[model samples]
Target: MSEQQKGPAGGGPGGQRPGGPAPGNFGFGPGRGGPGAMGMPVQKAKDFKGTLRRLTGYLRPYRFSLLIVILTAVLSTVFSIVGPKIMGKATTKLFEGLMGKIKGTPGAKIDFHYIWEILAVLGILYIISALFSYIQQYVMAGVAQKTVYGLRKDVNEKLARLPLKFFDSRTHGEILSRAVNDVDNISGTLQQSLTQIITSVVTLIGVVVMMLTISPLMTLISIVTLPLSFVAIKMIAKRSQLYFKGQQKALGELNGHVEEMYTGHNIVKAFGHERKSVDKFNSVNEELYQSGWRAQFVSGMIMPIMGFIGNIGYVLVSVAGGILVLHKTITIGDVQAFISYSRQFTMPITQTAQIANILQSTVASAERIFELLDEKEEVPEAATPIAVVQKESEAVPGKAIKARGDVSFNHVQFRYKEDTSLIEDMDIHVHSGQTIAIVGPTGAGKTTLINLLMRFYEINNGSITIDGVGITQLKRGDLRNLFGMVLQDTWLFNGTIRDNIAYGRTGATEEEVVAAARAAYADHFIRTLPEGYDTVLNEEASNISQGQKQLLTIARAILANPTILILDEATSSVDTRTEIHIQRAMNELMQGRTSFVIAHRLSTIRDADLILVMNHGTVIEQGTHEELLAAGGFYADLYESQFSSRKRQVDAV
Candidate 1:
């Protein structure tokens, strides 16, 4: 690939991680920079209200659940308030009753009936508080899970719609992290944190009201620390967001490293690059360690600080309330009630202050997930793409659509990126049943040509047509449905052999799948497996060989029975015996179909009716194998270089 195609920074040899630069990147894991890789900012919380408002839409479908959760929170808070009030009232009644009893008089003469009535009311409040709290916790959990489920589905669908280039630009792990860890953080913390907020506010309100009723002067002095605690809480939250964001980024990096290592471990072993990879990994691991410590350190400070302020509030209320009791500003029971109210009010404040970090981090996570969902797909079809229906006679086994299989590249031009053209001003035509071979060196646009033909990438400045009708005019899926491709990277999903063979023809009978496998010479090894056709093979189709894998892919294509077939580097990764078997299978599969072969194996395509030699985005030579050799052009030169080099090596041996 050219530098222009690669860009200044991309997935070449030196593409950095998502946020860039590991901790020790120079001759080690990172460079002069320490563990601050994501460059996280501790800015004041951005328009959190706006973010909260956006989140409410996720609750629309589960409005009833949301309603129940809200009601529970309110009810739970009311119970919390009643608990302290009940104790205070009963304490007062007990004190008065004791005084009457001490005078050797009937406790009822002092209207103990009123005190008993108040005590009964307190007992009733306690039951209500416990019941509401239990139900409220259950409902909020359901609400959070429901929101997260919908969000996950939305994110997944968005991922499917995005073009292949997006996957190339980002790591698999980063995308997976965005879907999982980030979403989990957003949802898991939401229910608890939101409930805490409600409880805190309610308790504060109830306590303040009760305290004022008893002694307003004492109440005012008690709440002096409340505002300061809130300010400190807010400051800690601001700091916590940076830490959480960094921590999340570090996790993504760690996951990405694991995925890369696992996927490419073979390459590491083969090239003896394991040591370098290990060193890089350890460096990333250590950086995560430091980042994690910092994030936890900041987030953990809120609770203790809020607790300290609550303690101060407690001391002030006690000193002031005692004085009020001594001076008869309030009765002993009233002083007791005021002290209970002060604790209630200050306690929730501390809890809310503690959970503030969880709330902010969730908001940040939601914003990130929304960002991905908001991405625009690269190739969107027209509102109504004209469809091409096939006749019953021409239709493939499972496909209902078919074209004439007559392909034409009309002044065709294509480029992986805009700066370089892989194919330009190319024109070619093939009948319904003809074979063409494309031969080229590395970087000769052979793969790009196939990509254009398959419509994986768009062509520029020209059009490709099937049966004189533009392919773009047809439905995208229908256009692709006419052909089958055997790519260099053969991806076999986790399933039984029969399922993989009949993957394209989903409703095909077992017999048809078996027939296709037999034609590809894959039946022998497949039947030898423990399960035969039912033998499961994701990556561990161990009883079979690489040749068998190639054959199986071919069998799948044959079962698909496409009118057009593309054999792109199909024989590139197998031994000589496997190549011969695959080549034979391919010839059988290609029969009576317009077939295109992209090959480095010149010998295989020697019988092709038309051979095109390509170089640097253009066809350098075109003719039959013999005709091209006689012309003595680029094709001839490539052929001579290959066979002659082989002959010289053999002679030396």
Candidate 2:
């Protein structure tokens, strides 16, 4: 019989004229670089270097902590680096003692005490290294968490400030991915990868220095193998990167499909689309499997190829050191240390390569976050806004102004886009406590009128006034507080029934909440539930029936006690009996408050003081129900058609 629509309203249909876009078509367009293109899209940062520079701003506050982490990482690497060379001394000592014993030299017995001393020094060095590593890790974790905390806070605040239009064109899932997953990526990198990079670089440098001290020729041989390692990594990475991109794109598509199917499963079942949904899922899944498999296989080649090249260098170094030892050019201890340093050298290079890839991914995540933050925010509110305060009887001096129920729209014009005309030269005036009912066909600008009154979308021209003061001059919060709205599509969050009702008014007393529920004819049914007022609704509020949910929303609006009431098919969900009871209660509630009732059922609004018949975002007729009937106009025909249909139905029965 009636329908209530809510959320961001846009300009007229097809950019023709007046009323803006239809209500509740919060669509998801391929935004910016969103993946609707033909290829497997790689999720790379649009501005990698610029994003990194911007990312440093988040870390700037933790600069001192980062500096300490760097110093400790260096210390940890230095201590760990010195251990191999020192242990080589013990190795050389043991080797020399064995050689001396075989040669029958005097004092040829192994020096166990000297070896023990070297082991003790080595143990102390390792313990200190571990301690420094632990300290750096602990400090870095705090810095990382705190940095992300600030980032998440900024994102949350930004979401609040964003206009309804921003949400209208985007999916909830896409926005959430940027907010949750992307931020988590940045946090992980800051916590672990950042410190690892520092340690790896320091170790790489220390190993190079140590190797040079041992044998320049061996170091040269080891260094020469690095080019081969680079070549292998570059080739594998280049090939695997495409597959990685494909894998990511497939994964994203799979996730989006799952989210859609799960949320709309009831609709899918109603339409017997289960097989089709499964087929779609399987197709995406197979694509993901192929790409993921190829990516992993190609990426897996890097380590083995690098290892093979490294072994070749190791063999070359070993042979060169052996010849040098025969000539007494370098001690065997130096050869042992050099070998250890060489292994150490390759590890850091490998680690640095891995971290480089991670850094790219992290910067991409940061860029997504920055893109969200950079979106245009809602227009700024009026400066020196008029306060909507309580009005005293007899015009008390120095008291603030209070809003009366009078509302007037003077020659208003609006469009969702500048090129189209949705609402053109629309004018209406309502006195205090008048019950105005809007009757119209679909896309008739019925909801748009309510939206403009609520200031959900700003009008392009003319002015709307309440109590002789411009609505734009009033604080948005204050202006909105003047009206109470109840829609056909009821919304309730996961909370106790009492809490949901009390949401209409902050700090409301328990008695007031119960009284409002009673007025809405919801108290009796609510008390029958297991937990009564304390009953918790699920996320979708599917635990309760539709009519009961509508009743709860009605109760909420009643509790708000706003100056003006806007009921858009508020009683559409209830049964005939419940609707009668609610209508009686609403009559009592609207006694002195201005009310705007939008409905398609002509019979329900017969007693309204004023009825506006609308079509295509413009008012076609305006009069009381009886006045319109006597005039034999558009409203008269609409009213006659409803009764005629009902009469025919009764005759058929």
Local accuracy of candidate 1 as per-residue lDDT tens digits, 421-452:
66779888878878889998898887777667
Top candidate when judged by TM-score against the true structure = 2
Top-scoring candidate (lDDT)? 2
Cα lDDT tens digits, model 2, 191-285, are 87899899999999899999988888899999999988888877777887688677767766787788789989999999999999999999999
> Can you give the lDDT of residue 307 in candidate 1?
70
Look at candidate 2 and tell me the lDDT of residue 89: 91
TM-scores, all candidates, are 0.81, 0.87
True lDDT of residue 35, candidate 1? 26
- Residue 278 of model 2: what lDDT? 100
Q: Which ten residues in a row have the lowest lDDT in candidate 1?
A: 1-10
List candidate 2 segments past 4 Å from native. 1-42, 267-287, 388-397, 641-653
